[model samples]
Target: MSVLDRIIRTTTADLGARMVRIPAAELEARALMAPRRPSFAAALCAPGLSVIAEHKRRSPSRGAIRVDLELTEIVRDYERGGAAAVSVLTEERHFGGALDDLTEAAWVCGLPLLRKDFVVDRYQLLEARAAGASAVLLIVAALPIRRLEELHGAALDLGLDVLVEVHDAVELDVARSIGARIVGVNNRDLRDFSIDVERTYRLLDGMPAGALVVAESGIRGVDDARRLAAAGVDAVLVGEALMAAPDPRLACEELACACG
Candidate 1:
């Protein structure tokens, strides 16, 4: 099976167990009581190339990325470095992340948080809100068109921003069909885990007009950020490079400055 398929399979099984334990009604109640979060979409819409620094422990392609840094420290550095927002990888099995990570990041940083996970169900949206996330990622490749529409609406109904992610032309069409306002173009092909930084540029023209565009993955440093910014990308979601840097704060500072 492809990596994306495997992760989704595992996520579905794990979600079932979690729902049975906490129940959807309980999650909904907790979400309703949670404090409001900063506007993730608005943050990305700020002038210049906004940076959405990600807190990813690991990935299926590259394993064990900065496992030592505390989640709070990472997020704090991102905020200090002028990141527009933070993305917390909350997928446990493949990414070594947990829902608690989102809660902790929210507690430590004022920046809007994006719960970056394989969101296949609405239950996860409730989990995100209750955990203090301002937004959630809904990948086009991960769900059917009908299901994607349902989850997209569900997230909005809960007052959470949705970063509808698309990797190619077809997926972009699907996003456009759903009228996604915030679209993220992922550079990495999830199936084989190969990355092409040019993928973002190739897909840029096809993005819906007036939509907030975010370039995700394979952003190495300042130059890439500058180029994407010049190309009209509103934001960049960077993880591996920043996470692997010896001084994450300085790395983020350079990228954010480059975009500015």
Candidate 2:
């Protein structure tokens, strides 16, 4: 099975256990109680190609990047450096992150906090809102069209913006059909965890003109950001490069400058 298939199976197993522990109504109640925060889509849609700085400790593809930095200090630095928004990786199995990371970042950083995770259920969406996430990621490769609509609707009802991610044309079509306003073209293929920065360009032509676009993965430098920006990408999601830097704050500043 592909890595994507494996994740689907694992997610199914986890979902069963998760449902037993936390009732969906309670989760929805928690989502409803939390104040609706500003969306990252609003933040990144501003003029230039914005930098969506991320807080990630590890990835299935790259392993550990920065296990040393504490969440408070890291988020504070990103905020200080003028990040358009902060993406907190909340995938525990693949990425060394937890839901608490989103809540902590939200409390510390004034920027919009996006809960970056494999959202396979509506429960996860409610969990994200309760954890203080302003936005959530919905990977097209993970969900069928029906499930995507259900989760997207749930997220919208909870006042959470969805960054629907698509690797190619078919997924983009589904996103558009489901009224996804913010579309992310991930250069990295989750199936085998392979990256090709040019993939965004290949898929850009088919994306709707008015949709907010984010170029994700393999974006390592000013030149890369500039290239994507030139192609009209609204923003970039960067993680590994920034986390690996000795001074992540300065690294973010440099990347932000590159986007300019």
Best by the lDDT measure: 1
- lDDT string, candidate 1, 1-260, tens digits: 99999999999999999999999999999999999999999998888999999999999999999978898899999999999999999999999999999999989999999999999999999999999999999999999999999999999999999999999999999999998999999999999899998998999889998999999999899888889998999999999999999999999999898887
Report the C-alpha lDDT of model 2 over 132-161, residue by residue, as the tens digit: 988999999898889999999989888888
lDDT of 1 at 98: 96
Best by TM-score: 1
Q: Assess each prediction's global lDDT (C-alpha) against the native.
A: 0.95, 0.87
RMSD of 2: 1.3
Candidate 2: which stretches are off by over 4 Å? none
TM-scores of the candidates are: 0.99, 0.96
**Model 1 accuracy (lDDT, Cα):** 0.95
